[model samples]
Target chain A: MKNFMALISGILFSLGLGLSGMMDPKKVLGFLDVTRTWDPSLAFVMGGALVITVVTFRFILKRKAPVCEQNFALPTAKDITSRLVIGSALFGIGWGLAGLCPGPAIANIFTGNVQMILFVAIMVVSMIITEKLVD
Target chain B: MTISSEFTPLLSLSGGIVIGLATTLFLLFLGKIAGISGIVRGLLTGKKQDRSWRSFFIGGMVLGGLLISFLKPELTAKVYEFDTFKLIAAALFVGVGTTLGSGCTSGHGICGLSRFSKRSIVATITFMAFGMLTVFVMGA
Candidate 1:
């Protein structure tokens, strides 16, 4: 049941990503390129999502546990470490360059785009390498 | 700055709402944040018992993208092109960065920020700033 819910959630999330033009690297880059004909569409996407979350998340979290789960697997770390800032900064540079993040990149895996395929492959390898180094 | 000609406020907003709904469902039912990066990482490094749901969720995303491509081919179409070296560089940065940071756009930007997490807020701001800066520096 939990897996099914996850499946449903993933589908819905991807559908939203697709419908919102978030799947396209160009669109994402367009949003990041603030100096030249900035695309505010990404902002709207965040805004719209936030509107829903901001309103309902509080109530949802108020419960002792989720309907189908025993506990919320929430993030425990609260520190603003250099790891967070530097890591995000690096991610931003990559995002600006490729306009592909994890979600859209994964979704585009089956699109038969060789670039995307390579990108995802390299990204996965990098993740593994980072993990080994960090651990 | 001039607005891009391709801006679609309604479509993007509606899409966002859909994303919001998905995350909400994820939290409400599974008691987990619908963070793509965290999910992927969990799939990679988490315990054995936790793998199935992550796989299912990821599979669902891939399937959903495939479904959308069939229904609306234009949505998933690649508009811009990047060189091979650049793509590799970008991918490396993203992979390492997301791992170190513990989230990405979905996890930190949406889920984390929505939850009013200080870590997420900082991560989001840092990424956004750097993203814009990179675009500016690269002149892309």
Candidate 2:
């Protein structure tokens, strides 16, 4: 049941990406391109997402415990450390250059976009390399 | 036809509503948080017990996009444009960064921060900062 739900959610997210023009690298790039033909559409998307999150999470957390699980696994660490900064910088760089983040990148698969496939492949390899290096 | 000025906002609201509904439904039905980072992590970790939920979560995201596209063909046009090399490089960088950060934007920015997580706050700030800096450097 959990797996099924997760899969469903992923599909929904991908569908949303496709529908919103997020799967198209050009759209993403346009959003990032503040100087030329800047598209603030992504901001609206983020804003919409933020509003939903604010309202729903407020109620969900009040339940004392999650419905299907014992408790929400929250991250405990808190510090403006080097790892956080470096990691974020890397992620940002990737976003600016590629114009596709992880969520939309995966979602792009449905579009049969060859560039997205190549990007995903490189991402996977990078993940492996990073894991090994850090280990 | 020229792009509707209202299209982005409308799509964003609708998308948000769908995501909210989906997250709520998943939590109520499956007892889970709709954190993509956690789902992807579980999928990769090979925890048999965790696999099913992770798969479902991922599937839902994909299905959501497909369903929307089918219903709204006009909205399915590609938005962003980038070279293949740049995209691949960016993907690789993000993969490394997410792994190091221990979570993605969805996990930290969306879910974590909502729960008043300090870690997430820090993560979000860092993510935004880096994002800004990257764009500045890339001149995109």
TM-score leader: 1
Expressed as tens digits, the lDDT of each residue in A78-107 for candidate 2 is 776778667766776787776667777666
Which docking category, incorrect, acceptable, medium or high, applies to candidate 1?
A: medium
Provide chain B's TM-score, model 2: 0.78
Give per-model CA RMSD.
1.9, 3.5
Off by over 4 Å in 1: B1-5, B78-80
- Predicted chain A of model 2: TM-score relative to the true chain A? 0.89
Lowest lDDT 10-residue stretch of candidate 2 chain B: B1-10
Clashing residue pairs, backbone N/CA/C < 3 A, model 1: none
User: Cα deviation in Å at residue B95, candidate 2?
Assistant: 0.4
Q: Model 1: how large is the Cα RMSD against the reference?
A: 1.9
The TM-score obtained for chain B by all candidates, in the order given, is: 0.92, 0.78
- Compute fnat per model: 0.81, 0.55
Q: Per-candidate TM-score, first chain only?
A: 0.96, 0.89
